[model samples]
Target: MNKEYINIALADDDEDDRFFFTEAFEDLKIKNRVSTFKDGIELMEFLEKASLLPDLLFLDLNMPKKSGIECLKEIKASSKFKEMIIAIYSTSSSEEDVENTFVLGANIYIKKPNDFEKLKKVLSEVVTTNWQYETSGLNKENFLLRL
Candidate 1:
């Protein structure tokens, strides 16, 4: 919400992925406060109680207890999170998964990169993006973050 720094959140079940995500942001010059949740249930609970919502939410599709798809549906259904940007950060790049999330109102889809350098590059591009302008021109073709 603040112009000085970005408030970023990630809901991912994998410990290594969460660690890498935070580390990537730390390496980047961008000023950001990163929050990580182990499951969608935890993430939704925090969102419900927190006064300040995250500017961007990176959601992993395979989380247990509450899948990212279910969380996306819930978030999209509520007016409270209308302004928040949802990015699907999943390892699965299946066409079905991509199509399903795109149609379900996700702002962008990012296939998880295998290497740390690639992850940093992807995160850097995502963080620096002017989401307000980008969303206005959002289309299925540009939904997925390529390389």
Candidate 2:
């Protein structure tokens, strides 16, 4: 981890979403290093070998190969990734998805905002959130971070 900035990682297949995600962090001016991956497979591969894991991870549920749900299961199953804070960043707000990811140990869930400004606001809020409190004891109510 960089001593000067928070290390944030995002895994999303959509090119446009990836662009907007990085842009939101840049505009927040919070001194964060944001790295993005195109798919869960790629993200998992990096995590397996990375010396310093990101302080937080934003994962999208749907993807062409190795869906986020699969990735979450894989991540949660391994002891090495136990402390990683994972947020379910996806367009889907399905109840099943929410409940499933919550059970799988996602730190939070966020529905993608259609407006860029809303997205920025949510991202900023998440970046500033005290994750230790939220992750210490998972609460169903706080599991989904509403914007």
Candidate 3:
């Protein structure tokens, strides 16, 4: 399948998890860029200064600097990034966490897979579906104008 390269940001504290996700992307052979942040505060800071905002964000529920729920609330509250696709990519399977994330305006909630095969499937679905917003021949300038 022909796929456009998309920029993605990931917010998670665990080093091993980060490495695993990076590996999963590599294994999938998806054309994309992935940026990583250890916490919500750092991710927010990057967003504020970043010239190129990510097409998708994968956020974890637990972190040291700021919680994912708090970050989600802030992102949803902001008009600047309101249209950006934010997904809750966490280990939590709690109903409350899922409900709250959606209420806070997350586009999707995905549990972190335990194995490489599951992670590969998750990555494939994410690239093929959730991140595939139709541009419909609109360039960045035109898209921004329409927005």
Candidate 4:
């Protein structure tokens, strides 16, 4: 709710990906607090007990214990996370993945970028956008973050 800082959460299995995500946020001008989770289970545990839920959640599709698709389904099923903006942050940009996540109620679908600067740009755009308005006009066309 506070404009001063944004609460961002990422659930990814890869250690390097998690580090890059946190680093990208650190490089951005936006004030944010990022929490990284090694897997979906850890992410779910934190969300369950957390009083202050994250404003934005980036989920990776593949994980050992639980997958991002599973996490997305669970989060959407619960009314407690209705206000959260879910972003499918994964390396796969397959039509099936995009279609599935869009149908499952995720706000945005972002394919992991190969370059660091591009990642920062993608993150900045996602963070600075007016999600309130963006969600209202959410569609398959705009669902996948192209840049």
Candidate 5:
């Protein structure tokens, strides 16, 4: 078995969602180094630390301490971490929330699936697609150049 690890960071307040996400990732047979943050504050703290940046981020909009929107703003504002792929993975299907997330520079906004089977499928697709894309290191200057 090729144990190639993919680093993924998740910022969500719901423990059940985190558990399900981890299970789904495992079921996909994806070698992943998954890190979970209870809320945006913890996520921001990890991101601020140079050693903790992951290859991808899954953010939930409604979180305590600091919302995902706030975290997105902070991450995008920083030249050091702006290029990291930040995806808004939330239960919210509100068009306003989706539009705001994209307008604030989120790479994508994904609706959270209710069923475990559906969630697994969604996660598998996301993981596969993310690896297929070539993502450079997080740097605002280079990100803007590419865009």
Candidate 6:
């Protein structure tokens, strides 16, 4: 699983958001494979039996069918996905949402940016970051609460 290219997945219902996400990755010119799921159920189904899981998974909180919180809880409870980095990518930046996801074992929380350039920057930073090392250095005071 130590491949050169990073495996990235995004689950968001908005078509424009998904387009921007893919476009950002392409514009960055990074060596990575990106996958998009419209809802939580689709994402869960893909990951449940997939041989190789994405190194990073970006989840949008508000969606039809199942919410990100539900997906996050399910993913965190499973030992098989302990290595996967879960980043909460949502429009809402509520403190409650932030605290809940953090407590639920999300690796990071990124508030969706309105500006396209900012989105690109955020995506780039998240993709380049060595999350394993970051998590090892994670403290209650300096948790991955926001970006």
Predicted structure with the largest TM-score when compared to the true one:
4
Instruction: Please give, for residues 61-91, the per-residue lDDT of candidate 1 as tens digits.
Output: 9999999999999999999999999999999
Residue pair clashes in candidate 6: none
The residue pairs in collision within model 2 are: none
How many angstroms is residue 121 displaced in model 3 relative to the true structure, after the best TM-score fit?
A: 0.7
Candidate 5 clashing pairs, residues 3+ apart or interchain: none
Q: Write one digit per residue (lDDT tens) for candidate 3, span 10-93.
A: 999999999998888888877888899999999999998888788789899999989999899888888888657877888866
Task: Write down the worst ten-residue block by lDDT for model 3.
Answer: 138-147
**In model 2, which regions exceed 4 Å deviation?**
none
TM-score of each: 0.97, 0.95, 0.84, 0.98, 0.83, 0.94
Candidate 6 lands at a TM-score of: 0.94
Model 4 Cα lDDT, one tens digit per residue, 51-71: 999999999998889999999
lDDT of 5 at 122: 75
TM-score-superior candidate, 1 or 4: 4
Per-residue lDDT tens digits for candidate 2, residues 58-131, read: 99999978999999999999999887889899998999999999988888999999999999999988878877
Error of 2 at 54 (Å): 0.6
TM-score of 5: 0.83
Name the runs in model 5 displaced over 4 angstroms: 1-3, 130-147
Cα error, candidate 6, residue 19 (Å): 0.4
Pitting candidate 1 against candidate 2, the one with the higher TM-score is 1
Candidate 3 Cα misplacement greater than 4 A, ranges: 1-4, 130-147
The collision pairs in model 1 are none
